[model samples]
Target: MTVSSGSPLAPKVVRGAFVRLDEIGIGVVPQVIAFQYNPETLTRKLKPYEQPADKQGTPQDPAARAAPYDPEEEMDVAIAFDAMDDLAEPDRHPQTVISGVADRISALEMLMYPPATPSLLTSAVGALAGALGIGGGADPVPTTTEVPIVLFVWGPGRIVPVKITTFSVEEQAFNSALYPIRAKVTVGIRVLTADYFTSKLTEKGARLTAAESIAATAYRAAVEQKKVLAAVGVASTVESVLATLPF
Candidate 1:
């Protein structure tokens, strides 16, 4: 697939908080596959610092517990694409085929990296400067900042902010010259909660907000529940064996 602005199939640019990926702009679009979503739920137990005991030695506050919230959503996906198609036409590009693929993968890694944070040495030096009463005279130090959050837009509702947690690549086949021609990259991405980047996103238009996240999670859970309920009579499992009729 081609993703260049000139390409016919270029991804449509959506307004609002949609984040652009592949900022460096790869010449070819990678075929994405094995996209999977993993939703999670979290809760806090309320058993105060110390439970008061009743006269019988039992706890007094048994009705204070609350139900857990609905699950949250995360996703994982793989992008497979060929590198160094130029190898077929060595006259077109000067670089070797192997180097081309290496370059592409290297760029992918850069995308996942969070901007550099202040180092221990820098903090130590700053402290020393303050102690010496030379802090005002010291040159300002440059600090790293967080990279932009990415938007995983599969379709209308599938769009969500994501943090890339993992990236794995397999070089499947190589040419006689030991140049890699085929490769597959598997990436694990976690969806950001609506609470994530609170200062950045809102629900006015295309941007996903915390309220939207809750609704999306609930929608996914309802769909899953429907599937489970449908299988109660039509599908069989350990539960079915115990309840099956004789013979």
Candidate 2:
């Protein structure tokens, strides 16, 4: 969550790459949900209450008290990265490693699991994307080799930070399931680029833009598939089934 730059090059634009990925994933899922539930229904379902009366029986304005935390109605998503130390001498560029890992993770998400609900998927993607860039001019291009690790979660659930103990390429293949139930899906990617190549590519800006575009596209595709599955489930509810039953 925190990025420190002791030197100019050390703090590359790529630092925001993971953050953008997270935002894109988080942000998109919500729109899918809203399309299904609609804003009016969501507001009616989650309307805040006025303050309750005090123990003394005096009517206390609801606004006076802190708002209650409703886990069922909230969405939580996060993005993070750890220092890359597992790469061999020839594969040490952090930016490339991270980008590659991110792409792989996005591909897995697009191809594998289905989301529990369209709303949940939309919220997760929307938040993920927003965490990248929304209120700005052109999106910032990443410069560093920092690999982005993204976690997308839905529902009113507890947020737990994932701790990285060791860095191993083989371990990365199965890292998605390491987190407990709170996170619906977890992704960990490693970027590795040779120092010379990274330096050469960083000078052009196009490479970083391409990587971002690809990551975003992959993320959107994955979430869209999740949304489709959710919609199918909703359409096939118990009521619908009973109505179709030949009694």
Candidate 3:
């Protein structure tokens, strides 16, 4: 399904009917936190090690060559992982959660028209965008603005991929210890799905649900470190915006 760009919430809209595919929790190990490496840092450190010019066109001084090079300083980044035990009791079933939300959204879309077209997907996205406070103000919306929405589609045989884009606002906050703009805010919708595999007696491979296909597609995109980081950054930005919004 496709969503329109005109809706206020279109920036954050995630639309689709999803069925439970599979749900399994995997343990996440603690790892060192590394910031995006700055190329300049490496260049600056290496510059000091360059060989001195030979004015006499002869062998350089032994003392100059024997000078010990200073080691490059490493930035210690702080990173912490949440304990799995701290998660909700009974554990939230990822597949069930995705399926329930997708079904609700699909039912809501059905009520919007006598005969639903793919454009209705835009309305569904707009509904979500509005709730998230994206667009829908007196100001004219920018045509070029784009928001990233992730969708997971599951089908009986294969998975389908769809990505929706729209516009959203951006906000920033100060950090006393670091820099003035330490945090940011962005409003958008994030769609996630979990798929289960089912084996058929007649076929050698397993059959997948419609929802599972979509979820698989989203999962593939999310597997990329850059995509995952971007998704998380947007989510964190939206959370900050929500916390400051006046009720």
Candidate 4:
């Protein structure tokens, strides 16, 4: 997801999706109003690993050094929607109001369960058939599988796979039947850290999804690294030297 100089300069439209192990598709696509995220870092000032030298043969400006740090990146998104409240065709999809809300909740619930697999049902049917003396072979027992992680893509320069950490739903209105018609949902997601990719989620080609998150992470790292380098005068020094070079 590198941004090339030739790429478009406009802000990319934000879109989100869920990536599954057995299937490649999104569970729900919400119209998000605002998306917020920040990288939180913890740094400890400790004795310098290698002290700088001066003409006096003593450590120069040696007191404490900030350790190399990686910030924890997390995102919070807000989505507001009104289902049956449309003016043009208020009844267009009367069922949509509640149905849409249901879909959103369903998508969140999926994070806690494994993707729908036929093996579980197949095994049960096979067992029943064998018990009934019908001609059938034993089906292989199914192992537990993990639910898919969601990917939020704001175009190529911003594609990150994330896990839903927390979410809240607030209903503003409801129909006569008490079904929600207007609601705002706030979802908090943590970017799947590189450590996670290298660990548990690596099985079954999940590495591809890990790569996507890594790319998003690289973008943040570049920004933070740039700031650090600029503060240390490295960036300006390099730029000045490069400017004097002949083509």
Indicate which candidate wins on lDDT: 4
Please state the error at residue 148 of candidate 1 in Å: 3.7
Off by over 4 Å in 2: 1-145, 148-208, 238-247
lDDT by candidate, in order shown: 0.49, 0.34, 0.32, 0.51
Give me the candidate number with maximum TM-score. 4
Assess every candidate by TM-score. Answer: 0.42, 0.22, 0.17, 0.48
lDDT of 1 by residue, 1-247 (tens): 1123456778643322223332111111122321212212222122223345878998867565543432344545555546555677887755645365655555556557653653355456666666666646343344446553455554443455566677898888776766556676666766654444442455455564333444345345444665777787566575678678686
lDDT of 4 by residue, 1-247 (tens): 2223444886544443334322222112222222222123222222324445878887756565643433456766665656643423656755464354555555555665765563444555556667765544444233447655555554434445567677788888776667666677666766654555555455765554433454346456544655776788975588888889996
On the 0 to 100 scale, the lDDT of residue 27 in model 2 is 29
C-alpha lDDT of residue 150 in model 2: 31
lDDT of 3 by residue, 1-247 (tens): 3335568876732222222221111111111111111112211112223355588767565455443442221121111112122223325544322232232223322221232222343445555556666645222221322221223232222122223222222223222332222211111222322322122323765575343444555454544544567788989799788899998
Backbone N/Cα/C clashes per model = 0, 47, 22, 0
Give the candidate order by descending lDDT: 4, 1, 2, 3
Candidate 1, TM-score vs. the true structure?
0.42
Q: Is candidate 2 or candidate 4 better by lDDT?
A: 4
lDDT accuracy of residue 235 in candidate 3: 90
- Give the Cα-based TM-score of candidate 3 against the true structure: 0.17
